[model samples]
Target chain A: MKFGIGMFGDSGYDTKTNRFRDPEKRLKEIVEEVIQADTLGIDLFAMGEHHREDYVVSSPETMLAALSTVTKNIILSSGVNVISSADPVKLFQDYAMIDLLSGQRAEIMAGRGSFIESFPLFGQNLNDYNELFAEKLNLLLRLNKEEKINWKGTFRAPLKDQTIFPRPKREIPVWIAVGGTPTSVLRAAQLGLPIMFAIIGGNPRQFLPLVDYYKEQYALAGHAKDKMEIGVHAHTYIGDSRQAVLKAYYPAYSFQMNRIGKERGWSGSFTQSQFEAGMSMQGALYMGSAEEVTEKLINTIELFGLTRYIAHI
Target chain B: MKFGIGMFGDSGYDTKTNRFRDPEKRLKEIVEEVIQADTLGIDLFAMGEHHREDYVVSSPETMLAALSTVTKNIILSSGVNVISSADPVKLFQDYAMIDLLSGQRAEIMAGRGSFIESFPLFGQNLNDYNELFAEKLNLLLRLNKEEKINWKGTFRAPLKDQTIFPRPKREIPVWIAVGGTPTSVLRAAQLGLPIMFAIIGGNPRQFLPLVDYYKEQYALAGHAKDKMEIGVHAHTYIGDSRQAVLKAYYPAYSFQMNRIGKERGWSGSFTQSQFEAGMSMQGALYMGSAEEVTEKLINTIELFGLTRYIAHI
Candidate 1:
């Protein structure tokens, strides 16, 4: 099974000064941390795409392209493509460029991004979210496979004999990031694409049934079971002890969860018990020492027979 | 004055081996080369965005993001942005992300790309190129200045009080890449933007007059002369001997020029004399040792009073 690390590119807060240092310096530090992770036998390094203050990465492809030069073996992937709001042609061209720069190490996970801010910022409609994703995803899939494509969609202009250049060394690997959406899972299966489960909260094993559903649906769609790669994404940290891990991660984690929870209408304070539960739960939060992380990952890998494991380390 | 190195991220052709290595390896090498150049006092390391196989960089932002981690103290800039075909919001967001990744080293040069392939591929109209660039550029400029903006245009939907997030550490510097168009020059002046002259194959001094034109226009437009920095972009290389440099660069240069020339109806069987002329000609190719290149750059700097010099190394 392949293992990957994800970065939100968060700069740790300096409580003493109570002010963030230069963001560029913080960003460079975050990238170097990822590079360090890449050297530690990590198979992939995925960066989240966010248009928020806390999260630094808005162009994951650009970060991946830069990472392509620094690391030797890690496959550079984008955590989300924001398909509903982004132009498919530009995404294809950008990732293809990433493939060219990285020697085919570029992989993209497409979904309707979790953040709604991108919609208005990009002059897109939240009302057409489903339709926009459907149309754009179809076009993106078509562009990924064909060198020259003729595609017309409501969201964008039509292409007549249009060829997107600088094709990948081979077909770029694409995954559909589904956040507990059965229809999205089915769509991915129907399209013969891999599914990346965004299991940010709850137990990891809770997703087993969904994994089963994907496999059955994929098999029903005539795709071999072995051909499908079941993957999971979750927040993580590694430290000397459980206390150390929580001490390092809790404030940021609580801040993010609370901020997102407020927006999503979830009311709950992040507690120590929940953090402990999440760490020890039969799920994919690989947070602990190297051994602890390895143990948790091995268990999850064994449980799901996962082909890829992505952790926000 | 600042000096920058640009790489095409060229993918090599193999005649003997039918199998080919991907450009990712070459890109890694190029990053190392840029780091070396940075150590050697190169001010900026820029990569162009191209979608053709002959050129490898599909997303210069991604490459720059990776470079952000590995190198120190070098400005990371995109060689050009295809403003006419790209979504400006995404463009700004991506560059903002690069800024976060590279510690405010990110800068972009916006242009109406030399190639027309991006138009059809992105489902945009070739006829509406001017309007598209105008609207997008206007939006981008607004986005750059404000955290939240209300924008509406013909090309895309309306944005109602939207703010792009992950704001840069500082104001992201942008330059207009103009190919000697009077209107383009005026646009830069009126917008109070810096202008980069894409002088590929002409007398450098000829553009000196255009530089004067820009200065006069900027003053006429009620802008300070120092607010607008004039830069020159030209192909370059440094090798052991003139003969060696010519032999190495000619084949690739001829192949690229002729490919574009065919579409544009320019005739040329590049010869040794023309190559020599380009080397000797003021404001032409920069092919020589470090001292040779430095001398040539100093001459151009003195002759044109250029504030920035971008070498397509």
Candidate 2:
């Protein structure tokens, strides 16, 4: 199976002093980490876009473009490019540039961003969020399908037989990143695009119907099965001992979950006990010793027929 | 004065049949050219933007981003980023990305663009061209000036107290590129921004008044004279000898000029006589042996007090 890792540049907090790594240092460290990942036979190293006070990267393509040089074989991708709040023409041009610089090792992961701050920041209304994404994705696909485009949409300016320059030498990979929305899954499947399921939480097995449904729809739609690959994205950690991994990751994971929960108004705290339960065999968390985590991954892949797996560390 | 060159792919013609270089080869050649410039003690190597079949680069940041990784000390710049047809927020992020990768060596040359093709391509009206540029320039300046912006404008979506991330460690230089527009020069001077003038045709002495007016206005506007830099961008070629450079560059320049002139409906055949005359001491073009061109540049600098000279070779 193809393996990848997401470099989120997740702010590290000292369980001892409650301090976070400096943003600049965190960004530079991330560059080093991705360069290291390239030497480890990793197939892909994607950077996710998050516009927040806690996160460092707001533009994933920028980070990926920076990593294009030091990297040898690892495919550089935007874990998600938040297409809902972006100008797709410009976005396409940036990725095309990355493709040229990286010797065609560029990929785009389009998603309706988890954080809604970009909607207002880019002067997009939340009511038209999905519509914006659908329209932009359509335009982006048209750009990919051909050099010149004649497209009209409600959100963005219409293109009239316009061609984006610095076009890629090859058709770069375009994956649809979704978070358990059946409509999103069906859309990707109907369009014959690869689906990247973000199983960050909840019972991972509960999403079986969605992946199976996607495959059936993809096949029914008559896309080549050999060319299709479904991927799963999970938060994972591997330590020498299960207990050590649990102890080290629990506090940091709890801090992050609490922060996200607070932002989303979840009304409940994610305690260490909940974390322990999530680390169980059927749990969404992949926190454990290498052997245990690897066993769980094998089972999950067999269960879902996943061809690609991305673990965010 | 600082010396820089525009790494224009120049689309080499088949000297025998007058066929242009393929776009891919043109782009690859540009990368090598810029790398050569860096090792040759050049202070800056910039790439200009063009949206046409004959031109390879439409997004300068894309090219600059790629060059940032290979070069050591040479500054990477968009010789002109057609800001009039671009979104300032996206433009800021791309250039900021370049700056971070290049170790604070990113510069942006903002221009209204010599070619009008982008206006319709980007869904902008020709009638509102200058107004669109003015509005976008204001937004770009505001983004450059502050981290958190509460900006409103007619051309673009309004931002309500939002921050543009990955702000450059040091302020990246932004120069106003103009083609003999007195009003544009006055605007740049009023804003205390450097002016990059295009002296492509006619007698170069004709612009002495404009440059003098800019300096007077710049001083009157309370900007330090020492901090002020006015640049001249001219067509230049330095070869083994005057005859060799002329014979080599004339055919290609003629092909390009005829192509552009045809597009703009300017019926003018630039014959060898006119080309030779244009290379005279008082003429705008800077072509000949290195010694002759260097002497001309020295004399021109003494005459206009130019702080930067960019040759589009």
Candidate 3:
């Protein structure tokens, strides 16, 4: 199984200042973490885009470009590029540069980002979020396939058969990252794109229907079953013991979630019951000992036959 | 004086096939070339942006990002980011990323590009050429100063106290590149931006008036002479002998210049007399042996009191 790590560049809450620490220092830690992961034989590493003050990475490709230099072998990508707020041509150029630097180890995971801050930040309308994402994804995919693009779209300027320069030596894999929505799964499958199912909460088994639907859609879309791919991303952290892992991760996790919760109008308060349940067998969280995590991974792989598994910490 | 090398990432024309080479291969050569330049103790290295097929880079920051990994100690910069055709926020993000990756070895040379192809490629109009550049440059300067900007402009969407993330750790020096234009020089001087004068053609003495005008304007604008800076970029090639250098670079240089010349209604043909004249003392082109080149650079530096000298090969 392909295994990887994901970072959001979030400086976990500082108790003294009661705010995140310097993002620059946190970004440095990420570079060190990636170097360590590469040495440890990790298959890939991805970073997510977040626009709020809590997250340092508003541009994932920027972080990837930094990581591309210090890490070797580990495929570099955006856990999700938050393509909904970005221009596809620019995204292609940025990641293509990373691919070249990493010797073709770059991939782009496009998503209608979980966060909405980028919408207003880039002067995008919240009403058009879904449409904006679909349109941009279409544009992003077309760019990877063709260098000289002649296209018109509503949300972005037209490409008048203009060529995008410095194309990568190999085609970059552009994956679609999806949540619990069947429509998102079906859309990815229909496009013959790989899907990275983000199961950050609840039971992993609950996503079985969406996975099954995606495969069915893949077949209907005439994609070869052998070539189709599925990846899993979850809230994960490993420690010597289950209690130790929870103790170390919960405070920060609760802080971040509550911080995000304030913005989205949801109660981000954490309870021990929810945490314990999420860490149990078949649960969404991967917080546990090596054996417990391994067994959980095995069970999930057997359930969905995942091609790749990524844990976010 | 700060001495550096400049690469345009131009694909040399193939005599047999009569076509430019693969840009991917050319880009790889650029990487190796920068590594060698770094080892040779070059102080800075700059890459130019072009949208046409003959040139590989449309995004200089992308190339700089790739180079940031393989080389050290060289200050990375764009020969000029065609700010007229770019989003200033995006340009800031890309270069900031480069700065982070390179540990503060990053700069930006902003220019109303000598070539106009990018203006059209990025959905801009030639009619608004000067205005577009000035407006975008104002925004770019604002970005460098403030983390959260409330900027409103004609060409771009309004930024309502929006934050541009991943600001560089240190101040990123932004230099203005000019091609002997009185207005451009005066603007650079008035804005207190350093100037990178491109002396690609004609007698070097011809630019003296414009340079002097800049200094007078800079003083009137209240910028201290000691604090102000200037740089020069010229067509250059080095070899064992002047004869070898000319014969080696002439074919490709003429082809590119003429190709560009044809579009601008000028005769692209080169004669031995003009070539010889251009390589002499007080000439523009810097094609010669180590001693000859050094003498030329020293003469020019003495003539203009140049702070930096970059040779475009």
Best by DockQ: 1
Per-residue error for B95 in candidate 2, Å, reads: 2.1
Per-residue lDDT, model 1, residue B197, is: 88
lDDT of 3 by residue, B1-313 (tens): 8999997888777869987787666777788899899999999999998877678787888788777766879989899889998888778877776787677888999989888877656678889989998999998898888888889989888888887666677768999999988999999999999999999888887888888888899999999889888889998877788898788876777667777778888864666767778888767889888789888888888878799999998
List the lowest-lDDT window of 10 residues for candidate 1 chain A: A19-28
Classified by CAPRI criteria, candidate 2 counts as: acceptable
If the candidates were sorted by their TM-score against the true structure, best first, what order would they fall in?
3, 2, 1
Candidate with better DockQ, 1 vs 3: 1
Considering TM-score, which of the candidate structures 1 and 3 is the better prediction for this target?
3
How much lDDT does candidate 2 score? 0.84
Alpha carbon deviation, residue B243, candidate 3 (Å): 1.8
- Residue-level lDDT of model 1, residues A161-210, one tens digit each, is 76765676688888999998888888998888999988887788887888
C-alpha TM-score for every candidate: 0.88, 0.95, 0.96
Q: What DockQ class does candidate 1 belong to? A: medium
| Residue A17 in model 1: lDDT | 84
**Per-residue lDDT tens digits of candidate 1, residues B105-203?**
889888888876677667678899888888989988888998878888998778878777667767799899888888888888888898888878767
Tens-place lDDT digits, model 2, residues B1-313: 8989985455566657765555556666777788888999899887888776566677888788778777889988887989999988888877776787677899999999887777876788889889999999999998888988998899888998888666666677899998999989999999999998889988888899999999999999999989999999899998899899777988888877887788788877778877887788888889999998999899889888999999987
Candidate 2 ranges beyond 4 A from true positions: A11-23, B10-22
Best by TM-score: 3
Error of 3 at B226 (Å): 2.2
- DockQ of prediction 3: 0.50
In every candidate, how many clashes are there?
13, 0, 0
